[model samples]
Target: MAERLTTQQVAEQLGVKVETVYAYASRGQLSSERAPGGKGSTFDAREVAELAARGRRTPMRPNAAGEPPAGEPWASRPVTVRTGLTLIENGRLYYRGQDAVELAARHGFEAAIGWLWGLGSDAPVTLRVPPATAEALARASAALPDGIRLPDRLRISATVAAALDPLRFDLREQTVQAAGAALIAGMVEALPRTAPDPGPDASLAARLWSRLASAAPAPEALACLDRALVLLMDHELAVSAVAARVAASARAHPYAVVSAGLGATDGPLHGAASPLAHRLLGEVLVGGAVPVVSDYLRTGRPIPGLGHRLYPEGDPRAVALLDAVGRLDGGAAVVAAVAEVEAAAGPAGRPALRANIDLALAAMALAAGMPAEAGEVVFAVARTPGWLAHAVEEYREEPLRMRARGSYTGPRPSEGPERPEHPVPSSS
Candidate 1:
């Protein structure tokens, strides 16, 4: 159900004055949105509760373990609920509690990144590009050898080339941010093109769809891509985001942080799941469906696309991605293919067993002619904005660089009374 809380209501819930609530919003601690027709600011009911919950955690581990009845006490691992997946949980995101989904939905791609960076949504995409790097971009564009197909590779390589130039060592935050933005914008502008007509919307997902489709997409397809971005935007510090934020907590620049994010994403456990889903979907798409799914069921395998750790009901992002794609004519056959496999698997019991975002997203990507490997690209690119936001947050309340003590769990050898095993024999 849709629920909006008044400022006063939100204040009471948090035990803060109404003015203090607005102050928090202003400082980027929490967010509020002005309703349509500019009537009034609306605070989300659940978000208020979330803030209360966060405050109550105190964000620190207790020094002592809880004592058991007899002797030893068990130490509990410190638990902190990550805020990165706000996009997924609430179907919205905040730069500093600012609405990212709304801006991305309403504005252009560059505008959305700007919104996340606390810049005006309408700012120009071109920021300062170091002169030497700009020259490198010029040289790379000149050397493209004409008619090469892979746009992302060209973009990625060009970025690696340009950013590696000696000038990049400046390490200033403003400098690094500009360099990162330029690398992205420059890549978009320089990618191999047939006619050079207006490409995708230049927004994150639209560009991703363009990358996958390899051509200008229709309006319907673009809308679908937008929804995909919102859905996959953030996913609760999924291992990749967590790794990236850990690096960022060390004052890593935006590009380096993103590179780390991409590295973590490249790992099999995180982003490769999507490509695996593509293969699973392909199995269903071929061979008239039933025999294949039955064979898959016998393998004692958890179906690839059908489950996730979070999202008890289902991966909202998966549902959102599928909704964006609409009913592609042959899509029913694929869904049927997966459904049969699920039927064989029997009833779902845990959130971990539910089909997650990766499956449907893979289907959407495949139907659109995306190469399987491109799933990582699609996911990583779509998630970059969200990752950047998390990086910024980590910086704002930078965690103290943590240290650890070594446990003496190594090994020990001691003289022991001899016991003979010679008398025993195997049953065989």
Candidate 2:
């Protein structure tokens, strides 16, 4: 064997997809060798390890105008996106200088997920739960109501129960991620199904559709939807995932942790908007696009199908998904109608109020014959992997319950040891 290894070998050694290894090399975090004949590259194992040892977390991001707050405004240390990228700069989306979209597309969902989780692979993290704790979670899961829907929600409860087994706050990152995955899988599988079996290649969405309704989904479109999972997998500190991480930090059981996530997800800001967008589409069709756009513009109200918070330049995910969905059966005309309506409406800074990824997903899911309620389920299912990955990340960095502060806006309402309270005057 030579003293050094090629880039391909380095990828094999690291157990990451090839591009990820190249990403590390590209970022100068991994050493590379110039080939004699051509443009190929190689790596030295010793050099790679040395560079890794020196590598560290120092998050850098653009603080562009109108960017959202990371809270803790008064704190000296501004939070940086160490493992995630937010607010694209100079037409680039980078997670530590690795092109996120390219990586996501090339390596599949799990690879991108691995990078987020700190383990950097599809590597399994198995925890040997003590018999006592295991038995306790089993009993609790059994005791849950028979008819309760939502597999992920049940897992939230199960994780909570599992945590009560007294081994929940384990510090290792792999342990947390693996345990969460296992818990979620159990909940999904255990749900009573009344439909045809999802084969090995069937996606979580495809499986969910079959389980929720007896309706079958097309194989090709379902695969696209599966890749859609990869696209939706992570965004920096989304509202629901924030709630999830907060709960995890408090040592909530995995079930309880994600339950907090699900609760937050129910709000209009996150999960509910997709269905609303769907309804808005229906209204636009019924009311006629011109009239609807005219009225909406007059009121200066935003249209549902157009625009997003993160992508002022346009959501890359939305662009990719819409393009992918365009290939679906009967997709083009429907998409064209929606696009025309949007272009007619989006003028000035509003930009035809272009529909984001959620709208496109809803459209595709509808075309695939999913029920009105199914989009949110698909969103939740896809997003959980990322949320749990983040939870594992947060768990690794700090000890439990990282003392989130709130503004004390109320009047000085305090009681002394003697408990001096304004006596209530009773009118007799």
Q: Rate the local accuracy (lDDT) of all candidates.
A: 0.58, 0.58
Residue ranges of candidate 1 with Cα displaced over 4 Å: 1-108, 119-176, 186-207, 327-344, 348-354, 397-408, 411-428
lDDT, candidate 1, 1-428, per-residue tens: 55888887887777667776776677665678997788768787877777677655534322213222111111112224355335444443354464544544575555656655556667734433345554666577667665454434533654564456555544454655566665554444444333224543345445445546665766766676665555555665677777777766666666666766777766557876788878877876776445665576678754677755465566555655565555654456655555555554554562234456677667776767667765665676566666666676665542432222244687665588666878777699
1-428: candidate 2 lDDT, tens digit per residue: 45777777766654456776776777666677786676688787786555433322222122323243222111112233243433255544554355656655565544555554555536423323344544555566567677554534444545554555454556465556666655544444444454687753444445555655455656656556655766776666778877877776665655566667777767656865666656655555567677777877789876664676667767777666667667778667556656766776767675456667677766665556555545566676667666676666555443333444355688785565554378778799
User: Which portions of model 2 show Cα errors greater than 4 Å?
Assistant: 1-98, 107-112, 118-171, 190-195, 200-205, 212-214, 285-288, 293-302, 348-350, 400-402, 413-428
Clashing pairs in 1: 109-203, 306-354, 306-355, 307-354, 307-355
Q: What is the lDDT of candidate 1?
A: 0.58
Q: Which ten residues in a row have the lowest lDDT in candidate 1?
A: 68-77
Supply the global lDDT for candidate 2. 0.58
After superposition on all C-alphas, the RMSD of every candidate to the true structure, in Å, is 15.0, 15.8
